[model samples]
Target: MSNRPSPLNDWQRHCVRRTLERGGVIAYPTEAVWGLGCDPWNEDAVMRVLALKQRPLHKGLILVAASVAQVEFLLTPLAPELRQRALAHWPGPVTCLIPDLQQQIPTWVRGRHASIAVRVSEHPVVRDLCNTAGMPLVSTSCNPAGRQPARSGWQVRRYFNDRLDWLVPGELGHERKPSRILDIRTGRRLR
Candidate 1:
């Protein structure tokens, strides 16, 4: 294999960040698969991702962050033990479903649910993407509903073609499966 560190370079990363800032949807590598991402706070962008995935609004979406600070806004109302429990698994492949106490998250991101899923990722590209964008991204598998997730940059390109504003070049992290979902309030493992 070539020694290329990742599918993206500094310039490409910058471009992707700009695209996101402009309400563009993008494709990028995640811990277990390629993921479609957009600014979580942008309704139109999030809608595009939902439409692109052919997923229903009630299914909700995931938010991926580079650090706890990036997602701390969603954890503020949780009980200290629950917040601590969720934080203990951070910077890794774990998606925690925390109650949206303030209801500040948009309906598009939360869907019809009272909780929103959030993760603090250790994947270099994912972290870089979130940090560069200055916020967590609405992250979902890079494929239509009921289809296998894209695992490579080529697959992402083929799947979305020119529809995506950018295909962030990167490789999947070591995770062999999507992040496990945990219900923070109930202390239950969802997946």
Candidate 2:
């Protein structure tokens, strides 16, 4: 098997970044399947993703970042030892719920909670997109509320059609399951 990335050209990356910059939702491959993402700070964009998935806002969404530092603000409020634990497990597929201090996280991103779900993604395109777009992205499985997540770009298109502003071309990673979401404060595996 080749290690080559899916043919996502520089131009397409730029286009997707611009779309997110303008508060548009995009579909892209993740560790397990294709995911729909938008600028977490953009309430309207986050709503668009929720509407696309037929997901209730109160269920919340995950924020994927290029690096732990990109999402450090949310975890900083945790106890020093807890913060270290969250940091130690990151730069991977684990999503951790961290307390959102400063309340800087948008309600749309955190939903009806005081904590935010966040991960420093190991996927190359996701990292590049976050680094280029300059913020964490609202990440959610690409499909309606009850359906299985789309596993390929074709599947993403079938699910969303023209609803997505951009269908970012890429291949899913080798993981068979979604990231294991952990509640860092309680040591509970939420999903």
Candidate 3:
């Protein structure tokens, strides 16, 4: 990652960080679509996201980070080659599921699985949101179940309206679709 700050201005970053700290859900742009996010450790926030999506808790959520170091606790235990493989596609749009072997991630984020999906995003707004919040944020498509993921801020507002605490200003990256998901342990593409 670069030493420079994220494109989000100081005030926007401050508000985003504060919202996450207060367990408020936010909507921001991602690699291919707008995303809803909140502090992953806050069950209330996570549950709120599930509720907004009309998604069952068993469906799980993805965690978006500013850097690999933000997820070292989950990555450190993997075999070196496996770790390398997972790292290679990151700082970009690929989401990979790593075994939550120690059960470190909350059940709300991991759902019924023994793994959690994560990505170190290259999207400026995503990195800014995660970095401003000082941790990974629960990232799910900003649409109710069965709806197409929102591709613009206007669509995000249409889908969620006043329900979101803050809508971080930004645009989607160049990716034409959502990140491809893979199970790192099995090399299987889940999406």
Candidate 4:
């Protein structure tokens, strides 16, 4: 067995960095499956992800992060209870829809929703990539809306070889499911 410091080797990180710097879309491992991601601030990159998924822009997307600070700019003023509730389940497989501040969030990122979906990811490669990129990334499953999510780099390549600018090889976490989503304001389960 190899004793690499991470699941991603240096070459993979290099590719991830280059793709993100150029506002490109990448397929990478996530908590339960592969995910397509791009700079949240890059409209073109975000559009590419939507196009690759054959998804409608009005459907919006989730932003995954290494920490709450990565996504703080997109959130509105929150009550202490709401903030605590959100914090309680973060750094894991739970997504929460927080009130959008509107000022920092672009229409493309927010879609037609009044809130933005954000998750502090527990997946190592995901967290490292977000932290390295220095911003939250627009994240969606690496597949067409009606299809199953890509669970491996080979599957990602099959689904988006020409469409995606890069692919970061890594292993999915132990979870056999997608993240659970909740609306902070209403405490409603959205997924």
| Per-candidate TM-score against the hidden true structure | 0.93, 0.93, 0.97, 0.92
Give per-candidate clash totals. 0, 0, 0, 0
**Candidate 4 Cα errors over 4 Å, as ranges:** 1-6
- For 1-191, candidate 3 gives per-residue lDDT tens digits of 67776689999988988888899999999999999999999999999999999999997999999999999999998888888889989888899998888899999899999999999999988988888888999999999999999999899889888999999998899999999998898899989
Q: Rate the local accuracy (lDDT) of all candidates.
A: 0.88, 0.85, 0.92, 0.84
Give the runs in model 2 whose Cα sits over 4 Å from its true position: 1-8
Q: Give per-residue CA lDDT, model 4, range 1-191, as digits (tens).
A: 11324656677778788899898998888999899999988899988888889999998999999888877665437777878778888889999988885546787888998888899997888887886687888889999889999988888888877888888767899989889999988889988
Among these predictions, the greatest lDDT belongs to: 3
TM-score, model 2 to reference: 0.93
Candidate 3, poorest ten consecutive residues by summed lDDT:
1-10
Badly placed stretches (over 4 Å) of model 3 are none
Tens-digit lDDT track of model 2 for 43-80: 89999999999988888899999887788777767789
| Higher-ranked by TM-score: 2 or 3 | 3
How well does candidate 4 score on lDDT at residue 126?
Answer: 89
